[model samples]
Target chain A: MIHLLKQQWWKYTAVIILLYVLIGGMLVPLGPSALSLYPVSIPSDTSVNFTITGYHTHFEDAKDLQVWFKPTTGTQFYKADSIVPIINSTVRIVFHMPKSNLANKHSENYDLVVNDSIDGTLTTVYAMTVAAGTGESSPAVTPANQPEVNQLKFKAFAFPFQKILFQTIRNTFFHVPMWFAMMFLLIFSLVYSILYLRTGKIEYDILASQAVATALLFGVLGLATGMMWATYTWGQPWPNDPKLNGAAIGVIIYLAYIVLRGSLSDEIQKAKISAVYNVFAIVIFTLFIFVIPRLKTVDSLHPGNGGNPAFGKYDMDNHLRMFFYPAVIGWALLGFWIMSVRVRIKLLQHKKSLL
Target chain B: MRKLLCFIIVIFTVLYTSAQSAEPIPSLMESNLKIYVVVGVLTIIFSGIIIFLLSMDRRLKKLEEGH
Candidate 1:
């Protein structure tokens, strides 16, 4: 029993880690969230009543919740006169907007930074903008900007629930890891193909073919998951974006590789031709995914591509990072486990056929 | 129990985030809006294929036993 356990440790680990992600990814409550500020566009030099609504924010127990309006151009955030709570998640703050000289030249955008003990410090950019207005003659108002509040607290493990990706963000665990698994499996197949060309081992050929078959399965799943994610979040199952098209093309190229292998009757001829084809397909696949998407002038729906801010900028917050890394590893290991089973079955079949 | 929690989260998200029905982001799949229904159908199809494959494997194992 111990000997069996020793050899199959990774199989157990994969199951356990996946169980953790399945539970932790969903049950983990999102940290205190601040969604938006009402009437985003506020006229300058007026004590305007701003309504701030948050999601899962603790306004009641907050010891200190300070609000500041930081102009995009300048470091200084002109402060509000007073902050009042209408509800736990909603706050009405009267911002004594000041007449600024910068407003004349350019419509300077202001970010709303809310610092609280409960939700930590969160900022929403372009929350309000001091519209570039005519140089006005007005009495000077007290623009007492509150100092930046330091909110450092030990946060619990959770997934980030953004506005666009609110519920669908959970798909991150399932969808993204499929691609990661596919890439690993495909790369393994590519390596095996290369090894077969070097040593001309029938074993290498079997492994290579099995790996490709598994990779194809993973790739199809990856595409499906991505399409599902796109359907809900991006309001489409498939978008005509360059990256999406390139990925589809890459999958088709691999499918062709599978078909080409199956068509040949002679084993040596099939192995030699297919192995060479695999090398060429991988090179094209690499260029299709890595090179083509980047050179696209048209914008992409996916982040980190086509002018959109990368996940590093903001989308993948620390909380999501906690589960995300584990999710990737779990899926990769699971893919390997399935692939190993298939390989064993194939080897058995190959052995039987030789009899 | 885990599935229950996940289901609840999905429901909660659908209910709450639906309030944020503002600008619909650009989508090419808008032409084939029925594609929203495709995922469920695909799932059923895949599940059937898997069951069939499992049965085939069992049959293959029997064939190997005779050898």
Candidate 2:
């Protein structure tokens, strides 16, 4: 039993990591979201009533919740006269503002800050705008937040699915990692092909074949998840886009290679021909993904395309990099485990055929 | 049956076009926590698949060992 534990440690670890990614990724609550601010247009000198709505507000137990209206250009917030909660998600507030200098600024933008003991604080930019507010009469009142609530904290393990992505961002944990794992499998498969070419070994050929099969499995999985994500984000399942087409072509090339291998009966002849094809396929697939996609005249809808903002930019703010990195490793390990099992089965079959 | 199929197609086309034009459907995220239910169901299906594959792998090994 102990020996078994030592031997299959990686398999267990892969399962555990995947479980962590799956359960923790889904269950963790999103940070407090500020949805809208009302009466965005207001007169500067006069006090005005404003309401802000939020999602997952946790107002029932928010022991000492604080709300502030901060201007984007100013050092101080237009201190609220009173912040009254209508419900868990909705709040109505009144604010007294300093007189305005229409010459100084046409419009004043205020950020909405909400701090709660349990849920922490969230600041939404451009929460409200004052048409005529910037005066000397109003004194700046600094907010006093509770020590516990003053600091921002996040759950130990959670995925931050951003606003643009909404729920669809969860697909990143599955889709992107599957592709990365597929690449990992294919890289080894490419290496095994090279080794097979050099040594003329049947074992290397078997390893290459199994790795390609497993990698292609992940490629298909990635494509499906990607399509699901696109249906949500891009509003279509199959966009006539280059990257998607390139990826599909890469899959087809390998699918043809698979068919080519199965058709041949001569072992040595088969190994030599398929090894050459596998090497060519990997190179062509890499070029399709890396080189041609970049050079294409068509603007790719994929993130990080045509000088648009990419994954990393959003990743930092949302802490997507944290969960996404582990997801990649976990999926890669699972893919390798699947490939290894297939390779072992192939070896078994080979042995039986020899006997 | 033809009428029913045509009705279904019209409904699908309408739904698809509406989704295409309107960028956000935040109510899906805001109300009833339906997204979590969806993600949960997907996770369960995926787990079932992995489990089935693992069992198949074990059986294959058992066959290999037996003969």
Q: Supply the TM-score of chain A against the true chain A for every candidate structure.
A: 0.82, 0.74
lDDT of 2 by residue, A240-323 (tens): 877898899988988988899899999888889999999899989998776666664757887665444665785444556656
Q: Write the per-residue lDDT of candidate 1 for residues A175-278, one digit (tens) a residue.
A: 77777877887888889899999999877887777777777776777787777667666777788877788888888989998899889998888988988998
DockQ each candidate and list the results: 0.09, 0.13
Per-chain TM-score of chain A in candidate 2 equals 0.74
Candidate 2 has a TM-score of: 0.70
TM-score list, all predictions = 0.75, 0.70
TM-score for chain B in model 1: 0.45
**TM per candidate, chain B:** 0.45, 0.47
Top TM-score model: 1
Candidate 1: residue pairs that collide: A231-A236
